[model samples]
Target: MLEEDLLYILALQRVKGIGDINAKKLISHCGSAKNVLKEKRHVLQKINGIGAFTLQHLFDKGNLKEAEIELTYIQKNDIETFYFEDKNYPDKLKHCIDAPILIFKEGNFNLAKQPIISIVGTRKITSYGRDFCEKLISELKPYNPIIVSGFAYGVDICAHKAALKNELQTIAVLAHGFEEMYPKSHKKYVAEINKNGGFITDFWHNDALQRENFLKRNRIVAGISEATIIIESAEKGGSLVTADIANSYSRDVFAVPGRSTDNFSKGCNDLIKRNKAAILTSAKDLVEMLNWDLETKKERAIQKQLFVDLDETEQQVYDFLLKDGKELLDIISLSCKLPVYKTITILFNLEMKGVVKPLPGKMFEAI
Candidate 1:
């Protein structure tokens, strides 16, 4: 976006009572943020949802003044900004109705066409949760997914570190602005994270860290990814809020089941019981649900092998596909007398072995 346009957007953000949704409405009604600010008060009020209170502060001169200062900070620090309507904005997040109209970023990673999943849980992570989180990322390394987290203690930090260890890009979504690091201790990871991926926030450069900001930022964590995983959470925690947001956005959510007696597992178990999330036991569960192993037609030639070996279950799935030519995933599972999850896992294995290939609409065929 042009600097002039960014200036108006930032100024619009400074206006009180006009949140993301209302701001978006105003921006859409008018041609741009510049026009919205310059538009007459009566004419603006004529648009739906634009009331006296919202437009009361829309013409504040200080809004532009503060925006100019922040714009200079952005230019000087080389901060990247993503406008909601811009093609470069995160594709998944753009679909969300409550998504930020503008988000500030400072990162070295590219989100284009990459598999992104947010891993969020309690700050008081247990040994069990830590192991599952690390192993999950390690197993998913082959798929080259972008790991996203809040950059706090426990599971969030663990996910970021695991991604870094596996040489994968990791994004840290902050609850504060670029100038403020909430946990001063996390400063050590900033340089490394910026090198591997980077930090993103909707807060301004000078905004102070606040408790409510954590909940507010959860939307971005949920919206930016194709899925959100909860490794561990107490009966109540921020991770649960993220799960709710993900569900609201209609994105896939997975929770690692844990012992009923464990405090940290209660939230995840409840999510599963409430039908808000799928049971996530291992990396295969996620890969199968997300169809990450499905190779496109162009890539099928290279993926197929002249000779390959398959286990009994894999062979059954492959043979069925061969005989049927094409079949729905559920039909194959019913014919093989296996559960849907197990059927998906077996089919993925066959795909990897170059014997079976996935087609559109959950259909599969033999090579």
Candidate 2:
């Protein structure tokens, strides 16, 4: 985006009562943030959802002045900005309805065509959760997926560190602005995170850290990835909120099961019980469920059969696909006499085993 255009967008972002969705609406109607400001009040009000109150502060001169200051800071610090409509914006997040209109990124990794997943859970993580998180990333290292997290204590930091340990890129989405770092103790991890992946935020450079900021930050964590995993959470926590946002965006969500008696496990258990997330026992489950292993890689039929071992359930699905050539997911479930979710899980296993491949429109076929 041009510097002049970015300045207008930043000023428009500072406008009160106009959120991402509505700002998008206005931008679409006027063609650009600059045009929106130039548009007359009556003309703007004629467009749907643009009331007098919403436009009351649209032309505030102070907004442009503040934007100029921030723009100067951005230029000085060399901060990278992602306008929502830009080609370089995150692909997954671009599909989300409520994604921020402008995202500030300071990172060393590219998200283009990357398999990114967010791992979130309670700040009060248990030993089990920590171990599972570490092992999960280690196991997923071969796929070289980029990890996304909130940069909070416990599970968030654990996920980031685990990704870094495995030599994978990891992005930390922050609640505050570029100038502020919450949990001052975690400052030590910033340098390493930047080297590996770095930080992302929609907040301005001078915005203060606030409780509401975290909730708003959750959307970025949820929207930026192909899936969100909850390793542990109490009956209530911010991780649950992130899971909800992921579901709302129609993205996959996974939860690691834990003992029923454990406090942090309760929230994850409830999410599973409510069918909000799939049960994630290991990294294989996630890799299969999301079809990460089936990127049109072809293998000789003999080689596929030789190296892959299928349990009874996986064999059932694979055999059906082999005989039928290609089948819809629902038909496979009914023909195999398994519940839909169970059938899906079995197919995922087959895909991971390289015995079956997933096609578009929920279709699957044997290798």
Taken over the whole model, the C-alpha lDDT of each candidate is 0.89, 0.88
Q: Could you tell me the lDDT of residue 367 within candidate 1?
A: 82
TM-score of each: 0.81, 0.81
Q: In candidate 2, what are the lDDT values of residues 78-184, reduced to their tens digit?
A: 99999988898887777666789999989698987678999999999999999999999999998889999999999999999999999999999999998998788
RMSD of each: 10.9, 9.8
True lDDT of residue 1, candidate 1: 81
**Model 1, TM vs. native:** 0.81
